[model samples]
Target: MNPSRRGLILGAGAASLAGPTLAQTDGLVLNGRFVQGGFAMGRAAPRAIVFVNGEALTTASAAGLFVVGFDRDAPPYVDIEVHAGNSVGGRVARRTLTVAPGSFPSTRINGLPQSTVEPSDPALLARIQQEIALKTEGFASRADADDFRSGFAWPLDAYRVTSRWGSQRVLNGTPARPHYGIDLAAPAGSPIRAPADGIVTFARPGMHFEGGLTLIDHGQGLITAYLHQSRIEVLPTQRVARGTIIGRVGATGRATGPHLCWRMKWRDRNCDPSLLIGQNAPENS
Candidate 1:
């Protein structure tokens, strides 16, 4: 239940969760990895209010289950503040999270559809904006499901990691957003399983950018998305367990070949899917 009290830590990356007791600072317990593009789960006194990154936007569960997320380009240090006890001016157990950097490699590809790489058509631009809004609304709500606490798995049985998180990408020699998801190379129509327990938030087919896309809510602001699928077997609001076949991999949307693009998002920040699996994935992943 209480992750911090139990001293349980998740995420296989370049960061470690501090022990249960701060000792020199206070009696707060925190767990979870600290690498860029990942998340950390922290627990404290039930009555304590937690502030992350100097913002009061983070909400702790009634059991004091608060989660912090780092983006792909997250800063080297993050500030965390905990207001413990009932005292008016409680101790500011503010801690700066030392984030471990993730090495990224640059990739270049030429001879792609210019419109697909960079939408120049007015109608297509409107569609792209609309799709982005729709995708954003997909995971806007937070849930109480504890599936993410368990961990994740590879959607495919075995595959090569052709791309990694935050890798530089140049489409037709024009720079674009760094890749944010891991690419699992598989044949078209290959089964894609759910990596962890979650509820399907949105499943749409043939969008302009992501093609067949599905968003699974794993609770506590933890979510994962399946992009560029040939087929989606799950529907919105459906509950799925780890290893369940949720879709079929394929070359859809703007992709170059058949593969599954798996992405993770914690609250509003992006996270590397590999970190949450509790094991070190291949370097290309």
Candidate 2:
């Protein structure tokens, strides 16, 4: 049986997406925020397929739940097409996604470990490079199921945010990749829960910079990572339910204090974790 049509109204005026006013479609519904570095959950008729910005997307759930996201340097707009499920020939619904612009703050830090801010030694550089390769291979998405449709939650029950996504990292006045994750300050032994249902892909005790880390694949190229963990309770390839304890927060590797760096990546693009499940979400979801 087709599920009842239920979703958030994301029209120009009804939405708080902070983007260009977009026209609404009759049957398409979206929740979450719509902006650069942001992600949203969408709903369509059952068995419906979707395409966003010319890229084919698999629905996040069997009930036609899907996701749309914008990159850090995404354009102002994107095109979306939803092929609705109907008894007869299905209808096509097309809509434009207006991605709002965002600004990143730059910070300059002087005091840091020599190996951290810059790894001048050949051995250390080699180790860092190997770690990067390991991460890239481990995080390669495997979206065989719609595990993420269950929704998201905070890793730490009681925590404070220390840093935000898209912050410029000026290490010793030299530019580096912008910080792409939200840093949550928690005690070293603070338990961390899985924000959503996913399969653990990478769970290891140490990395060059991340220290102990874990990656959970949530289908359709959507993966969430937990960094600076003091302990990883789950093993690779293990399925975990939402709210399951996956690890514990810690100050490891290149970190300054005890914290968990929560990050989300959709395909090859990094997205803001806060937008997907933070204050910016519609209805604070």
Against the hidden reference, what TM-scores do the models get? 0.83, 0.82
Q: For candidate 1, list the clashing residue pairs, or say none.
A: none
Per-residue error for 28 in candidate 2, Å, reads: 3.0
The lDDT of each candidate is 0.74, 0.73
- Displacement of the residue 210 alpha carbon in candidate 2, Å: 0.9
What are the runs in model 1 whose C-alpha is more than 4 Å off? Answer: 1-27, 46-48, 84-93, 279-285
**lDDT tens readout by residue for model 2, 7-94:** 2334543444433223354566665555678766666666677777766665434566667667789887777777776322477666
RMSD of candidate 2 to true structure, Å: 6.1
Query: Per-residue lDDT for 1-285 in model 1, tens only?
Result: 322222222223222344432222354555555667876666555456667777765545556556677888889877777776633377656566666676779988777678889788899999999998989899795776557656688888877898888788999999998988988898899999998888999999998878899999887667899899999999999999999999999888888898999998887888888777753211110
Count of steric clashes across candidates, in order? 0, 0
